[model samples]
Target: MSDHQKTEGDQSATQDSMRPESPEAAAHPRRLKSFVIRSGRKTAGQQAAYDTLWPKLGLDPGTPLRDSRSPGRESAPLVIEVGFGMGQSLAEMALAAPETDFVGIEVHPPGVGSLCLQIQTSEIGNIRIYQHDAVEVFEGCVDDASVDRIQVYFPDPWHKKRHHKRRLIQPEFTAMLAAKLKPGGLLHLATDWEHYAHHMYDVLAAEPTLENLAEDKFVERPEWRPETKFERRGQKLGHGVYDLLFRKR
Candidate 1:
């Protein structure tokens, strides 16, 4: 892969390899991670951002957010976005909604650092981050019936049938995600892969509590979600994007 591609994917590698949640989830990771965890060092800007911005913007694994609710900023809509690679769109959303508290969960170190840099450059204060497995963060850190919206955009398709099991939008994981939502809380997902979009729809449709927001089960990309350079590239390549929105019932 090109260095640019290696350092910054369109989406974060937030896939969970292990199916079950355990305390050792962090200790033992990446047996069959859905996306390639590209190996590299953080850029100078990213490293510098880590030094200057991480203390205020970073969140530790298993930090209980339900009780604290972002260090004295309570009563704001709590939005958790999984796999926010490079954080361009996530930062835009945070800037757009100053009244909302956004918590981004990404598994890549470069992504974490890059987003820290975005937070600094954008000068947005409503965003915090967790540089850890998305599944583990959802399982342990976020409390049930607490989140207002959850976003998972363009997770790896795992296109091969044999590797489909590693795809992040499995039944078990969907249920766990739905459990974290408050009643009427929304879950928004988008993907360029057709089959993977359907797979996501099937998994989320099966969840007992989530009601599909669209009558057709897919919706147009909302204005709140900014198109990333990666997504624009995909669009130019004639890729069709599908968005699925569901709300806890």
Candidate 2:
């Protein structure tokens, strides 16, 4: 098996150990998972970076963030991004905003490995990573009302009607995310799928604690977010991208 395949198998084994125990527990409506582990070969450079850089850049998913120090400056605002695929845009944002600290949550091993490489090569100090489920990390590790901003960009559309339940922008998760943000903290989301964009807008709008940042239900993409390769590809295919920004009220 390739290194990536082995890594994915190990992660799945670990997840299995933590699965609900009893048949009743299992039958109690399993949480809708937003991702599937897809194995890809990890490059030697990525593996090396994961080995060397992870000690300094990785965060334990079970550890509470209240005890952790913010990268660079203690007073720096903490920005957390969910599912930062390949970490390209995340690395760019961290580089551009050196005064702000960033926390990225992703489950894919190759993406984690690639981000480790980026952190090492760029000598980036303002970002940390958690290679685990974002929902679990938020609930178990992050302190209430502690985050300054939350970003979710280009999440899986889960386009099929039967798969809509698996989409990440659900109402319960939205409320939980809003509660994690301090009053006035921002939640920013973007998507190339119009259906998913509308879904996100409806979910966020339903959260009474969050106030929309745009006059319209959707907002134009902000200047701070770097144009990602996936986004460029979507544009080339004549896809419309929508951004939504909301603040905790």
Candidate 3:
């Protein structure tokens, strides 16, 4: 079997044992409180949906967070898409690949609500979600060598030169992601900002633990990615979009 297939085989063998206990099982139950405790930050329309749906669809305070069940089909491969704005691409990709499990992390209320709605309306059981900072999620919850793929689509470019420090794709953060991914695992990133793309290439290239999968420039956009309205607007304005794929070495 290829290395990817072998990883899946190992995942199946350990799925059951890796299931986490409910949050109530934690030593301090109150610590299990979700970062999304307040919906007030969301716009009225977003809050309305969140109020109506989160209670029913949201995971109980401490339900085992990751999808690790391998009953009928092997638990679909775990793929995490961060900053999935409004969940357009996330919902489309999950529907396109039912065999792949997905976990989405977003801090924006409207986006979180939209994704939750998609997960519910589509009857997609292969996905789960969390409302917290992506950095904390990687550092605290996700296990080493547990994630198969990590996707970051159009993170805020932090356009101002001084604000570039705030961009999500950085050496330190990429290193953290490398530590989280299984060997040979994939990291797929996209951005419309040319400067940001070059910055990403430089940062990733410097990382000895990862290998760039693309030869010359960024690869052609994958068919599976949904062209968001923002991307469309970018195209109309002459801004180019870049996709970068790297494998953990």
Candidate 4:
């Protein structure tokens, strides 16, 4: 193989070696995003899911929503749910708040499939999907100040001290996301990991343009975000849940 290809292969090997050897990792994290596919290639399952659900969700090709406005002369506020695993909360929010349009970004296939199935079964509209890295999608696809709210529930904590760099709730990423939100737009983040919860608080507090909505450091989990199976599993093991809500300055 060429030098570039050889380097890529070596990096893949390193990642495979680093993944946890526990059975839980195998049963759940089938393959890391970096190893499974490039940024945008949908697997057969994802493709089938989209094909089945996109129509029901009203996200057909040529859908006028790419620019963050509703069809016709009226414009609707936009909400984005990043790392929306299986999209349960997203669907609930969409059904509850039909006036707002929702865009969900996720990299996992089964999660996307599950969300699509739900959308089709529910016959819901007013949602879109971008099956890619949320950072790139936020910067490239979404317009400045176009979003009214951003929801990120239970993102991968990257719990290891050394792997902390890979955590999604970083200052740079949040800054980019804040720029996409309108002034006073809300950013909602939740986590079940104690260490990562404090990490999120520290990072968001340091960002100059965002302010915590809660009077205290932490906010109670709202009724809206129903606990998922993964979260329930964590809770059964005594993992505490934390939530942080902030508004753009």
Write down the lDDT of every candidate, Cα atoms only: 0.80, 0.82, 0.70, 0.70
Model 3 lDDT tens row, 1-249: 110122233343355247774676555433211122223255666567677667654543233444333466444578887767678788888898888878887766667787777776777666666666677777777778888899888776655674455467878889988888889998888888799899998988888988998887587887767787877887999989899988998
Taking the tens digit of each residue's C-alpha lDDT, what string does model 1 give over 88-193?
Answer: 8889999999999999877667877888888888788999888777777887788899899999888777666745766778887898889999999999998888
lDDT of 4 by residue, 1-249 (tens): 111122334454468568756887646743222112323345576568778766554332233346434566146878888877667878888888877788887656665676787676677677777666676676667778878898888776655565565567888888888888899998889887789889999998898999998888779886766666766777899988889999999
Q: What digit string (tens of lDDT, one per residue) describes model 2 on residues 1-249? A: 111233344465456567746888547867855455776756899999999988888899778976676544666798999888788889999999988899998888888898889999999988899888888888889887889999998887766675466578899999889999999999999888899889999999999999999998898888778887777887999998899999999
The best candidate in terms of lDDT: 2
Steric clashes per prediction: 0, 0, 1, 0
What TM-score would candidate 4 get against the native?
A: 0.76
- Which candidate model has the greater lDDT, 1 or 2? 2
- Select the stronger candidate by TM-score from 2 and 3: 2
Q: Which runs in model 1 stand beyond 4 Å of their true positions?
A: 1-36
Q: What is the lDDT of candidate 2?
A: 0.82
Q: Candidate 1 — which pairs collide? A: none
Candidate 4, residue 196: lDDT = 85
Ranking by TM-score: 2, 1, 4, 3
